[model samples]
Target chain A: MPITRRRLLTAGGGLALAGATAAACGSNTGRGGGGSGGSLSHWYHQYGEPGTEQAVRRYAAAYKKTRISVQWRPGGNFDQQTAAALLSGSGPDVFEVNGPTLDQILGGQVVDLTDLLKDVKDDFQQAVLAPKTHDGRIWGIPQTVDTQLLYYRKSLLDKAGVRPPRTLDELVDAARRLTDRRTKGLFLGNDGGAGVLGATPLHAAGLSPVTADGKVGFDDPAAARTLAKIRKLYEDKALLLGAPADWSDPSAFVQGLTAMQWSGLWALPQITKALGDDVGVLPFPADGPAGKPAVPVGAYAAAVSARSDRKAEAKAYVRWLWVEQTGYQEDFALSYGLHLPARTSLARKADRLRQGPAAEASRFAAEHGHADPLLWTVASKVAYQDALSRIIKDGADPEGQLKAVVRTTEAELARVRKRS
Target chain B: MPPAALRPLTSNTTRRQRNRTLWFWVFVGPFAVGLALFTYVPLGWSVFLSFFDAHNTVTPTDFTGFGNYRRILSDPEFRSSLTTFAVFTAIIVPATFALSLALALAVNRLRWAQAFFRSVFFLPTACSYVVAALVWKMSIFNGVRFGLANTVLGWFGAEPVAWLATTQPPWYWLVIGTVRLWLQTGFYMILFLAGLQRIPVRLYEAAALDGARPGWQTFRHITFPALRATSVAVALLLVINAFQAFDEFFNLLSDARGYPPYARPPLVYLYYTALGQGQDLGLGSAGAVVLALVIAVVTVVQARWSGLGRKEE
Candidate 1:
């Protein structure tokens, strides 16, 4: 009890160290029970407006038989939090996974959902499910399908006397008509670099840089044609080059500075909030010999942690959420408007989404979406984009650039295969 | 009589020696434990991992002796990353030293608000690197029409420059250097300030009495000797930081794949290879070991040249 300097210093230092460690490794589980009361903790990136919390609560209450608690982490940076939690063994029992960060998370023990999905495997769309499988095992259920669509200013399109294009040439004509010195036709101003350039075009061409077997098999004349079109657009001054990258906001398009923009279904709520009546959505124009329009599909998946102490409980929750819960689609629709339902049946039900341009866009993307098969390998897609972007931006020879990328990608694929 | 005298002396010497030994252990024990736990232990683990095909997950690991190192030497991406890191360090180290020294001199001359100026200069160091990078990415150096840099350029009738997007020479170097300078100048400024404060006033006074100008006086008497230790410290810190420049590149320039296009330093590349892209921990470990040796050799050479190991007068 004596206040000696030595004792005080020792106690203070010990307390400080303990506090630091706790802060580093602590879980923000005040809202959810961690396995107690038969509760399973779930974490997801925040979606939609203020009404989203209500929808989440509604879903949780309706599915009370499962005794699962959904705790929403409010931010777009869920990957960082999830990574830290995973490293510390305190990650959510059920969490979301993006395409690029999937391999990193899987390096840790992620649950194999083969048994869980066996009962309801046929209910989900194949396009949605394809990206979530690895080595013949289903790792997650696709929660939402995100496919790129062309957002255009309805008034501008009407004034320019143009309809949404079905082919690359038609798109260029439409773009030229809409473009002026003051206002450009399209904005592909990517801040990160050429990866953004390759995704849409590659998806449209149906040429993924990596195969399911982890081989580079994406060198095609279709890819070359897509690159050539992008370059021509850039050279003709029909495209704006300095807009903010990730310009998913429809306000810019609605404002008429940019006549057209490329974005996914995730931008629907914001677009509706900003420009409610003056927007239209169409699939990305195709350039292949088949002339079938294609849109790039992005998706989020829900996977249970392999390290979860209660795998049965987690699996039960997943089954209830994906299959048995009738209100799941409605919850998603109300929370994040324009989100494409992963289930084919729900997407076919037109009443699920809001009655506006967003609903039409969601329908278009869902029906015509094509995801790049390189979704499993992170490096090859990046390398491909880097190569593609250089060719477009620097006017490098398309064939030579594509060949170089193919070579690098094949080598990288070989390395991955050898190690695995 | 001689035996009796020798007995007391021996007893006294033995007690003193025991006391000194106890003090030495008391002073050194915590550091020894810390070094073992934080530094030596991880280092040993990395070295051991270098000899094996380690995975990030808790799977059964296989021993592939020197395979990772051999692969790293042959890997083109690894080679590119090493070259990038070396270039970054070479440019940043000298620039930071010169700027910090200049700032320190300017602050030393100011008779008012020295603390205020120092704090103002060091404020950037207080921010999280991610926050700083994001701010730089969105507001200051944004590529859009309304971005600060672009707006400024527009006023001069010059076209907007895509500072972050371009892969060309001066633009890429400028962006990297600006970010590096923003974070590092403050650290080196503090170091230089401390060194400047330690110089004796008598030397400056003597120079002034001899009709030496302030600039020449500083150069000949105070600045040269004062900066010896500070230069060594800054060089070593810069080398370590350059090798570990992950947060800036990772946050600002990174693609969705977690590899930056133009600015992938060796550490960022290692991270992308290990956990982000390939998930090849074996090659990543090899890259890491190579980076560590590079830093170690650089620091040792810097210390030797700067006389950092010499005893002070």
Candidate 2:
């Protein structure tokens, strides 16, 4: 039909009304929808796995005590978004955190979940709880555990006649020998070795980023020596400088862009699907006799906002979903992406994780896994990463850079100490 | 006091005046309130936050006067960001100005299909900077061998280059510069086209009558002199925009790992300072205030140099 002005205006108004109604309904998710216990809002960073969003939504739907709406945030900057949201007081009533931040602990942003997990606290590992605990109070319940280690191709290493690296020096030499026109020897990340290797070398050197006294521990000569070795690897052009995908994903390794890649255990499913029996796993190599190999533990946890009006309901949901609901937890961890269940009992029972590369990765994690110290604030990490970038990418003096980063870390630690 | 008929007319006039005044406020009231609420209020809040140690929270009780400013000013990373902004502006402003003027001049000389060419050239202006930057990063300048740039390089028997690597060779500048130029030049060209249309045809005819050539001499004398105001305005815009460059820089450079230290503009640095993992809003706000002041001073200096508001003499 030929449109007239009145008809057009009427249609536009109708569409606007519909849009307004839909938006009102969407925003009302946080409020009760005939539920007696009220409603809660929960946020999760968009997981890369296919079925994670549907799974979380399903779990939220299953909770009978309170109605919950899931807001799946997509982007690499979920932390920044969450920080802004919490500061504005419009944040989710329940949310996911990789580890409880210092501000979250000291500023009273996160509710203490210690009492919620009191009965089953023993099921969770101490290493997993260390980052979430502040002053002996657990701020979050562990949702899933991820471990980062090196993934190499068995076939490629055999062809090159290079065994798995057992030390930092040997790792660098292997990277050089394995590099060719077709592929690079190693992939630490697109930013040379700045990001994925930031804490790895420190762990390999038997050093913590922040010491028990809240002082910088990475400025020691051992840390500097390890970083310099990585720099030499970078200068040899044996490490992958830039790839379409970063080290977090196994795309660089599976696609033959790099022979060996530093990645997480979550990528194992995809790597095995692509490379079949050709893949192998190893922890980051040791730097010297004083040092031991280490696999860094990365995890996600669930927490309730202290300012949430539905704190009781939110805590109930966290307890129900993350703590009590083992079946859902196992599915959430294993179904979409391959990850270790937060509970040691669940991990021990999983048949898929009992053999092959998965078994080896779990063994390494159990033996040599390291998590960031309580005092390792984001400021210190940023400073250390910046220095690492300069050293590896720009060939800056590692000793001088580490010294400067120590000053920055010390200042950050002082702030944390003052706040606490 | 004068007459009965005159008094009624006076009342009618008063009523009309009242109606107009009511309508005036009705038109402008929401806009005024919106400006105050969204722009001015936040600006004032930012300045206030800069004076306090507002980390992770907007409402901070701890006041530290000039400490945030001093910290940001002393920061070498912040200082280098300023230099990055300077380098970006120095390259982009001139490059955009010349390219847009050239496009406008070429489009003006077209006898047929002028509208088609104009629309075609101006289409990219409608694209979002974030989307454009992504296309440039992922498809064109990606480091993989199958990327568009590398594919073309491979045709010429050259090794694939990591275009975004900030180590030794700064090919990232080329990638960033080209994307901005493509996105911005079309809009400026439209502005220049408007200026070109307003230029009196009689002047060109007069120059021709005075035995002037049609190509370079005519353009150098007549066209260049006439576009002074347009050039100044476009240059002013380009300079301000160059300072506010964030979307492309942030999206193109920032990865899951975090932003690289190199090629960080002032806005990106301030964004990281205020909002990134550290959550130092006070220092970020201070950096923001400093950046705004710098932009203002530069705009004023350029406006004065170009004699923007002075009567043409």
Q: Which candidate is the best by TM-score?
A: 2
Q: How high is each candidate's TM-score?
A: 0.85, 0.94
Taking chain B only, the TM-score of every model is 0.85, 0.95
Off by over 4 Å in 2: A1-37, B1-9
lDDT of 2 by residue, A149-252 (tens): 89999899999999999998999999999999889999988888787776878989989898766677886899889889999988888888668887888888
Per lDDT, the best of the predicted structures is 2
Candidate 1 CAPRI assessment class = acceptable
Taking the tens digit of each residue's C-alpha lDDT, what string does model 1 give over A1-420?
Answer: 679985686677668767977995674653244555666777777764556667766776676655666778875456655654554456678887664244543464577887877877877878768777766788877876766677777888898899877777877788888887457777654542254444666656665556556666567777777877777776565666545445544545655568887765667667766776777877777777744666667677888776577878888887787666646754674456556777767766647464676666665666666666634355566566666666766667888878877877776566555654
lDDT accuracy of residue A374 in candidate 2: 65
Interface RMSD of 2: 1.4
Q: B1-313, model 1: which lDDT tens digit per residue? A: 5775556566688898898887576657667888999999877777777777665542327788989899888877778888888888889888998898889888877899999999988887888888877778767776656779888988997766667666653365776678778877987898889888988888888878888788866576667766777777787777777777778777677644344345678877777666553555666777889988877897788778767769966
- Per-model lDDT: 0.69, 0.87
Residue A215 displacement (Å), model 1:
5.7
